[model samples]
Target: MRAMAYETYGGTEVLRETRLPLPKVAPGEVLVKVRCAGVNPVDWKIMAGGLDSLMDVVHPVVPSWDVSGTVERLGIDVPEFAVGDEVMAYARKDYVHGGTCAEYVSVPVRALAAKPASLNWAQAAGLPLAGLTAYQLLTRLGTTADDTVLVHGAAGGVGSLGVQLARAQGARVIGTASPRNHDRLRGFGCEPVTYGDGLTERVRALAPDGVTVVADFVGGVLDTTLAVLAEGGRHASIADHTVLGAGGQWMWVRPDSEDLSTLGRLADQGRLTVDVAAMFPLSELAAAFTLSQEGHASGKIVIEV
Candidate 1:
């Protein structure tokens, strides 16, 4: 199997396309033939040794953690899935067998869910990590139908889905994005506020009563979000939490098949939309990582294997 990997963590240049042995299916695991792999900020972060402290406590690693693929083989103990099942998964980041950057990946059955039939592999590939993050954060914040929730970075992978999901639950949604994406966010049923100077004031002018929950994907204005929250209101973030203050919890999403299944249903019903900004062949993964890191994407970038 051909995989892009680095023996030592450094930068994208350290990533090389090389032939490696195919991973063996373990108990309770399935081997998937990769169709499309999602590129995330964490992938590049690991590549650059950003998690060196955590890695030192664990193992130096291969990067990617999310994949949309078909099962080619199943382990003896994996009864939930069979060969040829199209699935999407958020693989455990600590796997020694490497990640979905390769032609094949082995993941636990609990981490896999049936892919939405309406979506292509590239679109399905983009959902797991970002979708799971959004799902977990919104649910953790106890978002309700009557709640008016504000989402920062509302045009981003996680933020985009967060806005749609919050609206689907009958919440009044407010999102922060650049002027160009105001229409897109509006299409998602959110009132879009342009992010920059006086962003909080702009949002306040739109919703004078105050927001019930703040899901901050960008950590740019944690203080401002806190200021705009109604009393007893919750705040959650998937990115930085250092400035989150003492009021609400910082959220780190854990992969769950249950959450993935829920997202799959939303996709299947056409209630959720995945905007894929670009697609690259697996061989061009380095360039894909570069594009994703540049932070100008309107949607998720995928690597087709």
Candidate 2:
């Protein structure tokens, strides 16, 4: 199998496409023929050795987490799926051998879910990490139908899905994005606010009662968000943890098959959208990593294996 891997952590330059034996499936795991893989910021963070502190958990990492593919074989103790079952999964957390970037990967059955029938492999590949992050954060914050939820970076992968999920739950959503994405946000039923000076004031003018939940995907301007939150309201972040010591949950999404199943239903029902801003072949993963690290992706970037 051909895979993009790095023996040492440093930068994208450390990544190389190499041929290696396909991974073996362990008990309760399924071997998948990967069709598409989703790229996230954490992939680059680990690549740059920024996550070395967690090295005990994550090691020579293959660098991708989300995969959309077909189950080619099932390991012992796995009963729910058989060979040729089309599925999507957020592979287990192992910085070193979480091998979604290759043509085949072995993922635990608990981390795998049936892919949405309505979506293509690329679209399904984009959902696991981003969609689950948005889903878990909103649910953990105790969001209710009457609440107004504000999502920072609403045009990016997780933010875009978060905006739609908030609306689907009947909450009023105010999403921060550039002027160009205002229409896109509006289409998702979000009140688009430009991110910059007086952003809190602008949001306040739109929702005078103040936001009931602030889910920050961008670490910057969290103080502004806190100022605009209604009393007793919750604030959660998946990106920044600098102010977590003050209060509120700083979340890191873990692999959850249940969450992926829920997201799949939403996508199948046309209630959630998986936005893929660009797609690169597995061979061009280096360029994809460069773009993802630059922090300007409008949506998820995927690699077709």
Candidate 3:
């Protein structure tokens, strides 16, 4: 099998395209012949040893967690899928090796879900991590239909999905982004506000009394979030852990088939969509990593296998 892997944690320069043995299908896991893989900030973070404190490292690590592909074979006791079924997963394992940035990946049944039929391979590959982050944050905050929600950094991958999901639930959404992306945010059913000096004041102008929920996708927006949040409203952040000490939830997306499946259903129903900012072939994997690390891409970056 061909894979992009790193022998040591450093930078994208450490990544190489080389032949590796096929990943064995362990119990309760399925082997997926990957059609495409999503490139996320966490991929490069793991590559550079940013997460070494939290996760154990195995040499020759493959770095990606989101995959969309066909099931080629099933492991022992894996009864939820068949050989030809198309599926996707946030396939992070208990350790940091054997990831989705390869021709094949073994995903546990607890993380797998049927891919949304409405999405093509690249789009489906892009949905798992970002979509699940948006979904879980909203669910954790107890968002309701009557709520007025504020989304920080709303034009980026996860924040864009948060804007759509909040609107789908019948909430009025106000999203903060740059002037160029304000129109894009409006298309996602949000009232766009520019993020800058008077971010709190801008949000307040839209929701006079204050917003009912503040979902911060970009870190360092806690001050604005607190300023605009309603007296009894809830708030959470996936990017900032200090939210835990501030009476807000510090969220991390989990490998739950149920949550992933709900996102798939929403995609199938035309309530959710994924935007692909760019695609790369396996050999150009380094370029993809650099783009994701730059933090300026408007949508998900994908690798076509």
Best by lDDT: 3
- Candidate 3 lands at a TM-score of 0.99
Candidate 3, residues 1-305: lDDT per residue as tens digits?
A: 99999999898899999888999999999999999999989999989999999988887998899999999999999889999999999999989999888999999999999999999999999999999999999988888799999999899999999999999899999999999898888888999999989988888888999999999999998888888999999999988999888789988888889999999999999999999999999889899999988888999999999
Q: lDDT (CA) for every model shown?
A: 0.87, 0.89, 0.93
Model 1: weakest 10-residue lDDT segment is: 54-63
TM-score for every candidate vs. truth? 0.96, 0.97, 0.99
On residues 36-116, what C-alpha lDDT tens digit does candidate 1 reach at each position?
Answer: 999889888877778666644223344588899999998987779889999999986443337898999888888899999
Best by TM-score: 3
Once fitted onto the true fold, the runs of candidate 2 whose alpha carbons sit more than 4 angstroms away are 57-59
lDDT for predicted candidate 1 compared with the true structure: 0.87
lDDT of 2 by residue, 131-193 (tens): 999999999998889899999999999999999999999999999999999998999999999
Worst 10 residues of 2 by lDDT: 54-63
Which pairs clash in model 2? 58-95, 59-96, 61-96
In model 1, which regions exceed 4 Å deviation? 56-61, 95-97
Report the lDDT of model 3 for residue 36.
96
Residue 21's lDDT within candidate 3 is 94
Instruction: Note the residue pairs that clash in candidate 3.
Output: none
Global Cα lDDT for candidate 2: 0.89
